[model samples]
Target: MSDLSPTEVVEIEICRRPIFVVGSQRSGTTILASSLRHHGALWYSTEGYILNEIFGPERLDETYAVARLNLNRWLAREGVTREEFLERMGLGFNVLLSSRSGGKRWIEKTPENSLMIEVLGTMFPGACFIHILRDGRGAVNSMVNKRTAPGWVTDITWACRAWRRYVDAALEYAASHPDRCLTVRYEELVADPEEGFEAIYQFIGVPYDRAPMDFFRTHRTSSSFRRRIRSRSSHEALADLWDVWPLQFKRIFLEDAGVAMLRYGMVSEEEMQQMVEDARDPSDESPSWTEELEGYRSRRDLAAVVERGVPRDAVMLVVSKGDERLLELGDREAWHFPRDEDGGHPGYHPADSEEAIARLEWLRARGAEYLVFPEGSLWWLEHYTGFRDHLAARYPRVVDELDKCMIYGLQSVRQVPTA
Candidate 1:
């Protein structure tokens, strides 16, 4: 302010800045990153995992540099050169930002970015951070409910330890980089996103426009950007809707992550463990009563999704009868098809043929040893009538390329079925 030049001011106005969002898995980092990405020039990904995969699982002095180098090479492979790459890298990031049209800033996001904030700071001194905080109890509950990595919720104690490690590591980095960090609570963001986004937009020097809200009105496809927006809004709303979760949900959540909950101001520890103990062993005469009830319900109500009929030693295809492989290997000894109606032929529709070819292509891509083809009357009639000729032409060489295996069916067939 004392003697700032006009040129410097102008440069600052147009310059791009790096933004990093950090948090444990399932802690609303994606929503924050995406919300910002919706209207900003930044880019980010869910969790790049590149740093962990390439430079080694633990952080090291050379890890950050190696990550940056790999990213640059990846970009170059995608047709960006050194100078252009640097400019774009500074401008924006996303899980994959190559498709972002008309954005000036580079943005990329990975939760592990927090672990390397110091290294990132050294490389790009202007990097700013958005650290998301979810209530530890809620976070733990969410993690437990999720299909997680093995042993994630075997006990509350281990969950607490894992949750604390990530949160504490993030906090330590943010503490050192006060000027470059913004701590955003998930509850606050969901409750008043405009208020939250305002803070974020100001921090990142982006123009805040509600125009992107209209983007939400369009029907979102399964994997499109709009899908990401809709999913976030739905998740946030559900979090608010679960205000009346059972006492068990709360106790399990708290017991699992109560320490981190206290550190983040979500709870106070003086809250006795007696409450949890009482819940777990509700003095209901028999200790195994609850287990018995669960077992009974599972046996009586739940569909037998896990088919026990398939012998442990026999190879189970669990396929549809109309599946070409089903007919082709009608009498094959090695293959076993599902007995259920739905698991059999889904019919000879155009989509079915296309789906079959796609499945074959996928199998080929994954290095399949055998190709299965059904030989039902419907399949033969369709094949003879060129029902799937277009697909055959498209993937002409797929069937011929199996050097190691043969086209076989679940059961051996005497002859191709004719309509």
Candidate 2:
């Protein structure tokens, strides 16, 4: 038995209104939401993927069904009845206050949640929405400047289209439900955090504390891509990373020229024409994980393991006791040494002068690509070369013959224990 202490786990919740934070990508959403996590009574995750699993890509027609499913799933997982789930969601205040400890609020933030605000409102009538908006020009500029998909790199035109679409959806949702929505522009947050947080504080009905705002300065990394990125200051700084033409185009066609911008009264008229021109030429490429290893083969192997009883792929070869447990776990074969009755070659002894050479030859003959002779075993085998160098010499042969095999290396600690 392990020596470490074991304790029972207790799950508790104290908040009722599930706070939903939504915003555009690279729009300071993570920093803002993660900062709010330090708030007492708040339990949240940055961009929970559960919504995508439940909702299936944010289409409007199926939104109601998806919301119901999400609610039901949450209820079942939390071991709460439907009535309790409904009450908790409606109160929006109970979950935070019900905790045994000081913590109280429960919230989740995801950029895609921006598209599902209406569905969310229907699901949790007591819910509050924090919509984080970045400057459209800066948003476009930021997308182009940072490590982005090939589509973003292909041209400023495509980037601008995406920006407008995201911002338009966000604004439309905000306008539709002004009472429930709280808009925090990224630029405002950076320039005057007190003002921005005051707006957030007022919307959520929580007293604003300046201390949590500093949490934004804490390092932020994109959970989706798993990359570290520097936080931007003002929206204008985002354009610093892009070329002049892209910045101009974002300012004109996408941010300044469009009716959406005019409605928001955000961008200037002078910027619109260049944005239109940029939109005329589109970049066709899109981002994908090209460097990731081909996963289909691994997936197929996993499926085989689950469905079939056969022992296949990366079996652990263990030295067995008389009980034969290892054989039960993995396919077994006799390992004869020194030319046994089966006419197999002799196993090399640790004491032999040419033991290392013999062991290598033995492995080659037995069709064993990798002979994992642990550290001390080599000294007995009369081997002098370092383990790494010895492996390097035979690596090519191993690849040619047994690349599919994985050999487990171990030190011979003790004789196999018999039960």
TM-score of each: 0.44, 0.47
Error of 2 at 147 (Å): 2.7
Q: For model 2, how does the per-residue alpha-carbon lDDT over 1-419 read when each residue is reduced to its tens digit?
A: 88666886757554445577887666777788888877664666546655545543434334333555674665445665444444444343344334432455667677776766665675467678888886665565556666655654445666666666666677778887898887887767877766777778778888767666777655443422112223444434433432345434633443332555544655444543334444443452221211111122232232333224322342222112221221232232323222233534334333443454565455445543223221212232235454334444444321111222223222122243468
For residues 153-229, could you state the per-residue lDDT of candidate 1 as single tens digits? 64555655556666777777777777887788776776666677778778877787663333322321122113333
Cα error, candidate 2, residue 314 (Å): 76
In terms of lDDT, model 1 sits at: 0.48
Candidate 2 to truth, TM: 0.47
Q: Which residue ranges in model 2 land beyond 4 Å of their true spot? A: 1-14, 57-103, 148-158, 218-243, 246-257, 270-419
- Of the candidates shown, which would achieve the greatest lDDT relative to the real structure? 2
By summed lDDT, the worst window of 10 consecutive residues in model 1 runs over 397-406
